[model samples]
Target: MKRTTFLLVFGVILSFSQAQLDTGGEETGGEEEHVELFTTPATKMGAATSDFGYNLFRALASQEAATNVFLAPISVSAALTQLSMGGSEQAQRQLFRALRYHTLQDPQLHNTLKDLLASVRTPGKGLSTAARIYLSRRLRPKQDFFGLVEQQYGVRPKALSGGPKDVTEINNWVSQETGGKVQRLLTKPLPRNSGVNTVSAAYFKGKWVTRFGQSGAMENFQVDGGVPVRIPMMQQDNYPVKMGADSDLSCTIVQIQMQDDVSMFVFLPDEVTSNMTLLEESLTAEFVQDLSMTLLPAQVFLSLPALRLSYSTDLLPLLSDLGLSDWLADTDLDKISTQSAKLASLNHKVAMETVPEGNQYPSAASSAHLSYRVDRPFLYLIRDESSGALLFIGRVVNPKDLMI
Candidate 1:
């Protein structure tokens, strides 16, 4: 398989609602308790959504090998799932299949998602997610569907004013929800004939648990095609990280801790020119969870680039490629409105930035001999340690290509 210079970044947040699911009883203790925590509906839903996130990333990456790709899988899945509530049984089935949630028949999926979203939006986590549904003024949503969406998804369907003001209002909502990290999500107004449109946005700006030292002079970052560009590189000596090598994927994996129980995992190929097709295919929720548990901890001299990447794009084509073309074109959402309504558009925007900031001071020289330098294209993901949810997944083919 041909390799592509790719970076996958995923983030997970702790679940605040897990405790509510626990029966009020004496301690089951030890391994059993651990199993219980992982088996919660919310956690399972998180895994399912994470799998969807990986698949979505694959679809986007295949379209353009050189361009960077970023997305908040949870946000997209949340929006689609919420919309599914207003869809016919067949429509629900189709959407579920696309989301890799066909096998999950639990009725608590929405409830679980609500809890998950709450946990994801917990203050001080440096991460936020928002999803909303916009309807054409001519379509009046059924009372039941409107109430369900608001109750479960925490968002009420808003009627589009069918003017430029609609665009501004939607953009303003997204900006406010994401702490202003994402602005003008919709540069132009939606099509006048658009029936139902969904928007999702996620923002993250996390501080490392151990901050990197001051950035050194500009360094040469090797791009995919042997091209190099000067960029600021953050350096830290004796940085505590979980580092390992995956022989199957032919890449070096490193896990750096961030605040709020979030960890950023970076997958660096053995060579800058190495292909990442295999690694990309190997990514799944189960694989990531297993890998996270198996890595060994060590202190290494770490060199990483300061990254600020913002990506916004219409996901209709990508979702269509993921077996949702029919759903996008036409679907039975009769529950939402007496008149026929189909998904008109699906838009997603995400922003992520990593600076040299950290919770602790840098350590002095250590007894470690290994060095991990991310000077080339790689894959990274941010994962929440508590819920095991993937908050963000992205690839950086070239830092310069994504700087904004």
Candidate 2:
């Protein structure tokens, strides 16, 4: 039998206060502000990679046992592009092709990656992006690569002397960048042959723009296509939400806005037993884009299960299988230094949660609650509404499994 495929990406953020942005509006926590991006969302590089991401998502989700899966496609691409800057011509071209940018000039790709990084790291969006690049104690990164990373990505490489002591610095930086939500990056130790290695992270969390009230009832969720298990269901009546139908997908699409211009979207098959293969087969970044942009605000009686979970993946084997074998096959990334370097491993980690609005239930706004109810296995998306940057994508086969 063909296994079902659904994709997931997640992150959880505790409240962090900073200087307020100058956008004439208070950001999260009533104090901090994010510096707006240098360019509009329409011109951002994250949008450019959506297609590539869509393809990559499907491939990653197709792996057996990935009943629930999540990965930051933009985060992964951001780090790869940075690494490519110091890679040889063939290596750079291979990287670009894998990300579906085979035709663009290097300058354009670099600029877009730079902007995409800045756009997500803006001060108050409950999202953060950071890159920690390490070089062998014996080798120094080239001055040209150093200057470019600083100028464009606003990050400087920190060289590590041999040993695991630098793990503290790496984890500390990850914690700082993720607001203490992510504590450590490596468990075993740095991968061997990690010449010019980089660790990339994207952490996102936002309270629901339209908060849900605790229904005080246990809802049933299917486990591995088996019997339903009871789980806490967050719900709201008469909430203005966007809803759509993809006849091709046989799934109903719903979009829920979260604070900070971020949105959580769900795609549910019309029936619990419906063939999700059909829905997964029709999936694409462009398809998601059109579905979201086309949803009309309607009074929705929405009910959804609360989610809290963390997941990580070693992307080396997966990426290699996806046609990036050249990078993993003892290939040389000679641009960083004449000394040979190979990306020993590429990993992505995330944490996500959806909680109530400070311990209060919302008063019902309308009578129609049947507009959308997520009762079975489904896919989810967290995205920057303005720039259409996808922050997270995930799937839920068993809601009970998602409870942290």
Candidate 3:
């Protein structure tokens, strides 16, 4: 009962407004403790129409925050609910089937991936179609889904067959993919006569297109609001400006538009030190709206101090926060069985290295690389270069983000 309740909550969040029940809310006064369930009908919707490329940026930023390898398939149940395709039960079944196929890497995984392309009804529908086709192809021999996966990540997908012991192959694949940033996850040998795992990865290596002088102006960076750190600060004046709402989160978004139409949105409180949790907890359609309305052009002699950060995290907690707990469960496997068996958990790791590419912007060029090392999670995505439509989404998040 408890597990079912939890899955229910996740289903609501992933499907977005499909459930139409208050699964999340603070109770007030003396009232009966109630469980919320989906009762309202859903409508087929398009991507956020107001914000140009909004979903694209949001998806990319989410991938950046993932410290370890991340893998998650499209929530067919959740997605279908938005499209008004079926009842919650039907959606749930579809989602489960997809999960099962990915987990077990069944040849059926290919067909399942193909079937999903037909039903997806979202903004940039064409892009979603191409992405699904690519993911299905990865399940075939000699067809590498990772290369076709489009999104930038760092992990490989593992097929679930025989038993939960194929950790070695997963680990070796991780080592090769990440260039030795992480290692060793499984505690035992893979079962004999297991099938192959299907995985996807994204790797980034970028430096400031304009390299900052090794010896440059130094200033104090507000590490934790006031906790200052004397760091190398890179100064920029009159850089190309593109602004957007960081409303999807608690922070105000500030973007530095670059060549090739790629840009980075930095998430920080309107005023630094604001509890990040405000943005973290209240992130949703309503919250994103608040931020989007407030975006405006601003001018300043911006100073971005140099800092090197490397960290990794297990995605279970964050995914749970986003209402995506099924991927981490034993029973909620994607219908990816290559044979008759299922899987345990998808695992992964990630790493990034950013440095100066060398230049003075107006005087030169600037660039950066965001690389991911995924050892466990494998489902990933890729979007259209211009339209921001989600092109591909897959899952491989187990025993793959480690260094071989």
Candidate 4:
């Protein structure tokens, strides 16, 4: 049998919740400690848990603290969890804590992920989650890791000589998985003599329940503390959406539904300037959960940026700051074939678009339409509708910000 070691190092960027427990959580918890990731009958509690994980990551990865930062917390979590299959004990602990699940101590976490992936991937879902491992020609991981990686995670390892060909192959895989939304993941040359590589990706093409007009008009938007510029604002009048104001952060919160039980939450601060700091500080899991509970459904006019955006990030330093420095520096890969190697790179890329509504909608009269228009800098989250699990979190200050 060939010994195989995993190179669970992934670099991805581009992409971008809730449900009923229908999972029977209480029965399992009483007899076993396997805190079913699906811990409730209604996807709400589990969704709440997943949303918290995303927030924890957002807190750590916000490099431009006050600028336009976008990410799929779900993508980040999935990528790290995929890496955990090959991590040492200490590394697993650190990764768990960073993901806000350190104390749960669930033995079935990975298995739960397997089940969740299966349920979410179906016909016409409009969302895709994928994982791939590319092993260096010279390195062979232990047999068990290879088997588990494929059997449980649904990822098949592709062996390639690490060079220009492998780079193109890896990027091509990402492009195919994301339906060509993401073009290239590895723009820079790969580190020579590397033994492993990993890639985790998510892609979602959200179709609006109530479509916006195809041709949007240019409107003035406030970005970066009082600077005004014209950006195309996708418009839909009398859009039925949930709305609320969060006093804790003085931000207005809006939630709009997409197909397949997914929703988008927008956080617009009352005061345009100096509020992002407060808004970021207050965006905790508890805050999100409370907002989900309190938001009331209403009719309003909605205007959001009609631009496609993509981001690429070098995540090693950020991961280090989130308490994984030791794992990166003194990694123990005894679980895999004892091929000594450190995490070469962790990059992420995501592409997201707010497309216009499909059919012409008759204008419905509603007073809320006069007041609710997102014409300035704000934060947005796309998530599961019932569970409120975050799939993507991003800030929009410039419509052309990192257009991919």
Candidate 5:
């Protein structure tokens, strides 16, 4: 939706710890299949085409099914945007299949997907004949999302909402459920006296198995919007870089490949005076599919800031700018929200802050979470390791407010 609302929702739903396998793999001491949960959530939330999107979808689907999460809480919005941009209903189904595939992430998680799908895609919701059958056929009956939620997060919704609840109770429950990392969500001032209108909060934390160095921190890296700011620029020289171009945009991505041909392609906006959207919009499925055939490596510097930031913005305007007028329109986006839905306007505030747990460099032997800072705006995606299908996509303009 709007930038602020997106951040606020992100802060609310994703306030969990560094994502880990949800009890379904030997790697993490579970019986379920072991799949690496990357920093990127799998689906490139708003992107229609990108190498990361294509490759991620194929790789994860082929190897192990995946489930993608979009913090925007506006799947319909995202779906509508894609549809308006020529993404068909079939494309939306494929998106759901890939996203619902997260069952492979963990058995419990998978079961959750199964139950949710079954519950929501019932027979009488005006679904087309084909759509009803497709929904029924695609989902499993034994899967229960509540089970997965309990197994993964150690709490149940029933316990959280034991009695009749008000807005304040819901916010408190979320805060307590997420270990106090989230607060003031749908509530007024948190901490009883902070007096800050705690609209919403989301948190995500991840670490590189192989951390980077902190000694070479630099400053004055010009971020988006031509603004020079002080940041700890983590630099890696001689790293492999893949560059490609399409009718839409030219791009450079770092390919982090894993077992069975799965890869995570990171695309950064090429430095320019205008903005990063030029580079991002130009990236598309055809372009990435073309590049996948001929990925060449070039030595380059990967500089990232080591900083924690919090930001606030009004996103109604931004969402409108991004072609999501349907949601902001007075019609109330009737496609998704029914007359019974109780939620008010979706406003969001997100913050991301990370500290180096150990030394910042590999040679020096440290554990540092690679936190990205986009004073302007940046996009990221997770691609299938093998087929180059996109699993998840997201963007951040003001990284400071991200509760990582």
Candidate 6:
């Protein structure tokens, strides 16, 4: 039996005070406002990696046009960043450029990554990220390289035993790290002459800050071409959300809050059959950050389908399209081992689910008038509000395609 790889990437948001909502046409007693800028290394690194994440998403979306695409961009970046630590200068330059970190200096990049990883893995956040470097038993990695990865990334390199048991061991590790949401990451044995293999995984199980009422009824979800499929849809009246519209992309954006400072931004096209090319091309870390600040607070009737999705794919081809084909074809990881070694494989898997659960009950005092329904294909992203890192990004072409 061929075991399939399971990957998922999604996000959540936290509720905010109505005072923070920019309700247009509101005037308060004139008061001065002060704003503090976040120019920390971790934030800078997050912005850079997020750009790479958007690039990766577009590449995948361009290929799989009407199919669902989900991935943890930060996880993939972490895995490749670790690999670059063991690469020669030339290889390092190529990898860093592909990751959109060419401008960042050394040592600082690694240090910032350490800080960013720590921030995202805070306990009780319902989010976790992990990475590992699997080396062949026959090869001996440099002690300095080994120590840096373990100390900085929090995972020591594991020597592959070159046996069927390696598969079980790797799968078990992935399962444990992802809280059992992702399992059997390695369905087959490691490839022959496998010099280095990297695995990165992220898992999120988010609860809404304001939970929706589930009616236990299936509703018709309009896919491309206006075709409809029945699926469970969660509804909430007077839902408090930060909403905005972008005429350039011809989409309406809504921000939903989940627990633990995570915000899920939904981009819904005006029509069921609207082309997503323009919207997809407009995604970037800066674009999202700027858009978030511009949204106004609104009370509206909201309907969304509960999602449980997992996705897995080889990243070499996608990276190649991003101008890293030469590095993928012939790597120079001289710093990793005395023997010439190249990357054997780079695979990423993620699993995420959003249920109709929340921290508090709905308020009945809502004076909502506007309505927003997610009954069609749309794009979404999960971001860590505190660190400004994108935990997950995906396109939901059809909710019924991968239910549970």
The Cα local distance difference test for each model comes to: 0.80, 0.65, 0.30, 0.63, 0.33, 0.78
Residue-wise lDDT of candidate 5 within 1-404, one digit each (tens)? 11000111122112321132132123333223112222222322212223323333233222321121123222222222222212234433433343333222342433342333232223321110000000111122222432433453233222121222434665565455334654554533222211111122343333333243443365664444546645555454333334332223433444543223334455555443224444444445444443443344333344555544332222223333333344334322112212211112323433333333322333332322232223234455444443334433445443333443
Error of 5 at 231 (Å): 1.2
TM-score of each model, in listed order: 0.88, 0.80, 0.44, 0.81, 0.43, 0.88
Q: Write the per-residue lDDT of candidate 2 for residues 169-209, one digit (tens) a residue.
A: 77788778788776567665674446666776666666777
**Local error of candidate 2 at 30, Å?**
45
Candidate 1 vs candidate 2: which has greater TM-score?
Answer: 1
Reference-based TM-score, model 5: 0.43
Over 124-223, each residue of candidate 1 has an lDDT whose tens digit, in order, gives: 5678888998888788778898888987777888878798999999999999988888988999999986889999999998888999876754788888
In the order shown, what is each candidate's alpha-carbon RMSD?
7.4, 10.1, 14.9, 10.4, 16.3, 7.6
* Regions more than 4 Å wrong, model 5: 1-168, 176-180, 187-202, 223-227, 240-248, 256-265, 278-294, 297-299, 307-343, 347-377, 382-404
Candidate 3 lDDT, tens digit per residue, 27-96? 2112332121111111001122112113222333355543222221232222211211111344344433
Give a tens-digit lDDT track for model 4, residues 172-248: 88888788877787786567666555665666667777787634688888776556878788876677766666555
C-alpha displacement of 9 in model 1, angstroms? 25
Poorest 10 consecutive residues by lDDT, candidate 3: 37-46
User: Which of the two candidates, 2 or 4, achieves a greater TM-score against the reference?
Assistant: 4
Where is model 6 more than 4 Å wrong at Cα?
1-38, 105-107
Q: What is the lDDT of residue 40 in candidate 5?
A: 28
Model 1 lDDT-worst window of ten:
8-17
